[model samples]
Target: MCAASLPDTATFPFETAVVAGVGLIGGSVALGLRQRLLARRVIGYDANPEVLREAQALGVVDEIRTSPGEWLRAADLVVLASPMRTLSPLARDLAPFLSPAALVTDVGSVKSGITAEMEALGVRQFVAGHPMAGSERGGVTHARAALLENAVWVLTPGDHTPLTALSRARTLVEALGAAPVVMPPDAHDALVATISHLPYLASLALTHMVARDERLSLLAAGGFRDLTRVASGDPRMSRDMVVENKAALRGALARFRRQLERLEADLDDPEELLAAAAEGKRTRDSLPVVKRSLLPPKHDLVVAVPDQPNQIGAVTQALGASGVNIKDIEVLAIREEGGALRLGLESPEEVSRAAEILRAEGFEVRGRG
Candidate 1:
């Protein structure tokens, strides 16, 4: 059954949940569980004491442990939230102390290799999971429980993975307000390679191309910035992500190269370029109308604000007070004198309400209908 079909619960599913690697994803999971009351007590384990301390201070976790020990014996669920490369080693290190009933999972984007390694290590009740929600920023400071809200979380169970364990995973994922889709590990890796990893690599390449030319740097505007935003995310984590799934990433890269070659060959022909651009826009517009994807086919509005203090904050606060939800917000352009902010709402009603609210707050608003 899919996560949507799973019955929602008002009671805690796990008594003591241990999250090893209290980084952004890990910390978010910890915070979500505690905030939703999915776990009675959430314990954090991290290699860095500073991160554990920070997590506790931020109320991301109820308790912090320096290392995995007998404390894990009490954990009903264990989340391996470290870097992709470190997951295997970390699992092996904690294997001795993990309780037989504890359900183990990871939030890493890549799943095929680590799933195999975990199974080989004889980890009891291991299920592969990847939450398609996160920011490029890393660390507990940037972690928020809302990151998992309405996200697509994939779960890949190995051959020996029991139905009970998978059920438990789906329950937890749904409890965290994420939709869970179950698929094979290989399938999940291949899908993310093209959509997630390729985008990051493409953004990185674009940023590098612009950085090499000093004059181009100043000319880089909204479009360039929008295309390369992912390039500014945590480089270390991104490196591990692309490298961990290199086999699938290489395949994706080949497909992307073919597209680039076609574009390059047609650059001199205005008609062919226009055709490509039109088709590209059509395909982009057809993306799944979900929370993290395209935001319901873009109920977009642009607000013009002068270069003054609290301009952006005032606009958002006004919308908030009026019960208008902003699905996506972007700074289209900013100049010395003024700038434009693009906001994506859920529907035409929201868009209309938001524009009227912003106008009342003394901002020039326009919709891209």
Candidate 2:
């Protein structure tokens, strides 16, 4: 569907949003929607009352529903953000209570299984979405307002999904500062198997390998730590994802094993192995970086200012007073005379505005490449 024909941006028609689970992804979605969208009310439903209360206390939801059926009846959009195992049964139970006009979607990592169940439950408006953004942290406490910023959110709409519902879902994702890409359900699963699931499995394997050795772990530094960091993910979550995407993940692992075997075979010859290692490093370094978000253009400008303690704050205040939004700010360099601070703005206009404001306030500011 064309973007213009979708829901009007002036008024978000979703009066009440029902979030089925109040974990990290669900809480973050509620917090982001409440902060950014025009929705009148947001309510949450979780099996655990403690989680429900915590979500309410954190201001992630306007109301907490003890019974999923009660709020599910009136919600305009119902999001299933539960763990993978509970998704199918929850969809079955909540299907009858959902309003006929309500649009439903899930934040589950695996899509094919849930999409089939949702279709079986007569949820014609269901769209499967996987937001490719997460931290090693878990639970509602780790939810952040900027969690979805610059993230790639993939939507896998089923054959029966209505155009109107897909449009609304896209708008909701975009409002939370994510770029949406549409793909088929199986295709989405295949891509994530290589990029997401296989990597987690590899991390777990690497961690296990290192743990089996006593001496190597003692000497392990940043390289090993960085490579195995994802192994710290919740065991239950990792297990669920691996099981759901096993077929695709197995294929990915097989391909990866062939590469590993090649390297292992070349280990007998030191010169050949060194050449292989150098080639791998060159290929890795030459790959282009991914800039995932399409919401707004960003530009970095460097400005030199005095090294005084309050100088940074003074410049920031001046920019704020001039109504300029600072996307990011960093101390790029510190010289004997002064330091250069890099400022990231949404556009060149905001950069120019900030520069003018700082200069007018008697701070020496210049744009840097």
Candidate 3:
């Protein structure tokens, strides 16, 4: 990998960012960057003029351009947030115009094809990134500032990728309040194929199987409904994803089929099937639960408040009044004496400010170490 100079701050390296595609991922990225004050300017380019207009009107992007080539020439960073199928062609189209010093990345779920395309395009500073975050909803309208919070953003830098650009990509993800995890492109694709792509396919199949059956719809219960909920995702996006990552998805499906066959064979033997089910439960239970926030609070602040209907709201208002942005707040414990509300802030300084403000307002406050 080529090494370049590391920037002191992630935000310092990228003065301007051009986002291609104004869908959910692209819009959310632009929004996140703006929210965190990461870039000086963010321009967007989308095939659909309406989507581009919507992004600009919603403040998801600072400006809209007709072509990426026009904006990418001067951009410090170019983020491709389009569907998987468009990634390769987009890479090819943007490669010649990309600034040599600029870092290029994408939000495509599949990486191998894009990596190959980048290689063919002779793009040396490219980094493959996939943010493991999304909602059931699609488009720029559904963009959320906190969408990437606590989410794992994977970076797969190829052999020719510059170390400077890799560091920049990590810094960019951090600025968005996301954890950057590095993995090989192939491995990332294979893992996601099982955890993400395969699940979507299964959900799609489950929903279709039931919908096509005349009797199954009436018999469907909460379990079926809940399991197949993701099937309602954008059909075009889903279709593109499945077709784009066919190899990995097919391999995952084969393994899943084998497992299902094994379970079917043991179904007649209740004891064997029961043991298998127990083993599966054990494995599932052993998996660690990922916290919702990538940047969790280092310390917990416990505040004692009077047991009242609006005590929590009062405490929050006091903190806000003191210019302390509460990261999280929850009612820890409630009693007749006073209820203990825990507030999670970004840093100890914010905690101190909140505590002082709450105390000044005549509420007992304690900062937990």
Candidate 4:
């Protein structure tokens, strides 16, 4: 799939690029590099030969290797996209083969430990990176180059990291349609601990709490499903992330506990509770809207569809035929007989076009701009 467009004058910077893992994130990195013409050649390495084979067959890479070898000597850019736990050992394994001038980066969620270890290993050009984008689904088969489009990609370079290397890293991130954010490794870990790790733990705990009774589970609604979605992610990866960043996560947990304690103490004070709820709503509403590069903010079109087979397909196919691309979507409500789908479109014009097309096809369309 195509990513958000880059400028016409964008240059291909690397002669050869290597992705050390051919999983979802790695495959996406390879595809993005190839699709954007950022690398003249994309090479892939994975511990799993089957994955490498799949990635090659899927055209995610120009060539595949089961292990690091002299092949890496040609790489000017290398992405460590393996699981967090494997990064350290993987770095050491590939270090001997890496070129002295190659720019190294990783997609590990937790950064402090990996960055320190990579630096200790004498990786002179290391740039710690984490893309704030992924899916619950895993594997190269589900990978999409556009997954990183408009996503925030954090880069954490150590104090000794070379400026040239960091600049190339930022260029790579931007060329792939991601926004590059620079921050220290420790700060990155601390922030993600609160925003990312803590949420996964909460989702897990909530899921376990609600799953104890079959009766209660049957009654669970959309809110419960949405809140607990992270619990359904790859559990092993989640476990590694929480455990790896336990210190910061514990800090986040304590802060959350304090908030909960305060809410409990305010149980008899409706006014205080109302004030807290209002502040939360206000803060959430004030968050920035997603923009496609320099384009205007996206708009939504909610379409009502019947439970009849292929209804969802019909709506999307109609829009596809009209060249309307849905930026995002959510099923607002569903029942045995029908459901409401909220489709996020690229522009107000697309919303209007989609609304007209769906209405002509007899679907109930709402929320058009």
Candidate 5:
């Protein structure tokens, strides 16, 4: 699921990459590609001329093209960042234009429907990928290059998917500073229905209920604001996501309804209420403490730690001596002799500094050019 240190190749992973839409997700990808020097040329295409112009002005893309076919024809990697409804038609339209060696992927939240459509359309070298990172804000103006850092980017590669094509996509994902995870399309859809799609609906419904009771607004505080955060996302995108994944959403809602009824029935049972509270606490504790990938970014430095003594501590101490801060450090692999540590820093500059310091300290460091 993880890349072996950013493809250690002489040539760039891709020659030309075209992002279909220059909105938040697409813009972020383009920014990462350009910032990491992962692609030689990165062009963007958008139907809205004004937004396209804005994206170009913001330096989100190197070039802006009016015709998708022309750019797609020249691209070796294409990312479909457009809305869900537009994905199917675009796949069919771009199928003929996409080069035989091209690898196409998407950032859509839903996957089952899109994967099936692309498979049917005969799009060459297509991989379904979804980056588990975003903001409530929309538009290229809000995009950041570090949007994919430390995020669990899921790639749904089926039996027919080419291993080399998936490797190319993973190269791009790793360059974006995100971990690539593989799964089946149907399983991905089913899982997101609970973790991704269901939560947004719950927030929307909770906000609506609060709005109906104007008195509740006066009592709304930290808890209410935190619960309704996702409800403030772009309406168009949220509507498209819920509608496209309605089948899974329906099942999630039905199960949620049963849970709600059970809670209602337990209103008079103190023991049941205590048990429910304990269960909620356990679930919350079991969940990973996810960090948002957009701000401050995440830069990693990988080093092979020697087994004996305080090698890990010595590495950190060297960086600490120079006043560099560490965000989150993960042990990538362990062995009887030692282990490989992936040190997460606040920015690319910090990554460079840490690598230099580690190398001076006689550590074999390999990460982030």
Candidate 6:
């Protein structure tokens, strides 16, 4: 970011950093603090003494506190990585110790409950967030500084949340090499149910069904292994997620069942089944493996170009020379003389810069954000 674009309040150099749970997400946050030099001092708090000692020894934190009361007042930024069940009461308990200006955030998957707690506190300094990155493992032993790199960390800020607090959350997320995505709590919960939570349940069911049939296990292939990997995640955590997000999970499961029924019906028709698989392949192939947003959401811009070779190369070279990274690009249409190229970029700044470069090169550019 340019100097003019920088916020008046500096984003880094947090006076004190506190990780409340000191487990996977919390330990990773502490490691990120040290790695980025974002905090002058780091402290960790966990209910388990062994986890705390292990985390400190791993250099995840500069110090380990027996309790939040010992360190909360001094913390300029606090990350609560505890179980969702404990968040509401914990936040209320920590409220007395936190500074008026201190920023509070969490890594909870289910957002609506904790976000409601933050709202109940009547404090604008709270920002609700959930990082879309994790392994089948849990605990600080699995935590690393690079855990969040290139991950999509969703920031669910309610209308009552202060812009400054939300921006502070974003800065911290970016510093950890994760992209910050703004979303509402209900929307985030619903989306995750479809893409994350429900999938875990599906994987678990598939794994159980195959295990019950000894013959099926012997015939399991790479596809089965890959699809069932998420079922290996911490059972206790998965149970909590299922119970907490039951409303959304039920809806997602219903949709999944409907799709499955359609597929089962198509099994009798070879042509229909083949068509469905072909369409699915095309859709899946077009999706990026990992969404690594450096600064902005990917926006598509359609530009008219001649139906000629080297035209796409010229546009890419122009944008690349101007320091604008194109996230994705595709040829849309071809007329007798020209065609349209759709270029994907991060922000309006890139769109403006890219369009200037393209127009200078005698190509018609169009932008939509």
Q: Candidate 4 — which residues are off by over 4 angstroms?
A: 1-12, 288-298, 301-326, 333-343, 348-369
Considering lDDT, which of the candidate structures 2 and 4 is the better prediction for this target? 4
RMSD of each: 5.7, 7.8, 9.1, 5.1, 11.9, 10.2
Candidates 1 and 5, the one with greater lDDT: 1
Model 1's TM-score against the true structure: 0.81
User: Could you give candidate 6's per-residue lDDT for residues 211-255 as a string of tens digits?
Assistant: 878799977765677678889888888888887888888999999
Q: Between prediction 3 and prediction 4, which has the larger lDDT?
A: 4
Candidate 2 Cα misplacement greater than 4 A, ranges:
1-11, 265-279, 287-369
Encode model 1's per-residue lDDT on 6-111: one tens digit a residue. Answer: 3454346888899999998999998888877778788899889998999989888889998778878999999999888898889888988988889999998999
Candidate 4 residue pairs that clash:
none
Candidate number with the higher TM-score (2 or 5): 5
> For each candidate, what TM-score against the reference?
0.81, 0.73, 0.73, 0.81, 0.73, 0.71
Q: How displaced is residue 363 in candidate 3, in Å?
A: 30
lDDT, each prediction: 0.86, 0.80, 0.80, 0.86, 0.81, 0.82
In angstroms, the error of model 3 at 46 is 2.0
Comparing 1 with 3 on TM-score, the higher-scoring candidate is 1
Query: Model 3, stretches more than 4 Å misplaced?
Result: 1-11, 287-369
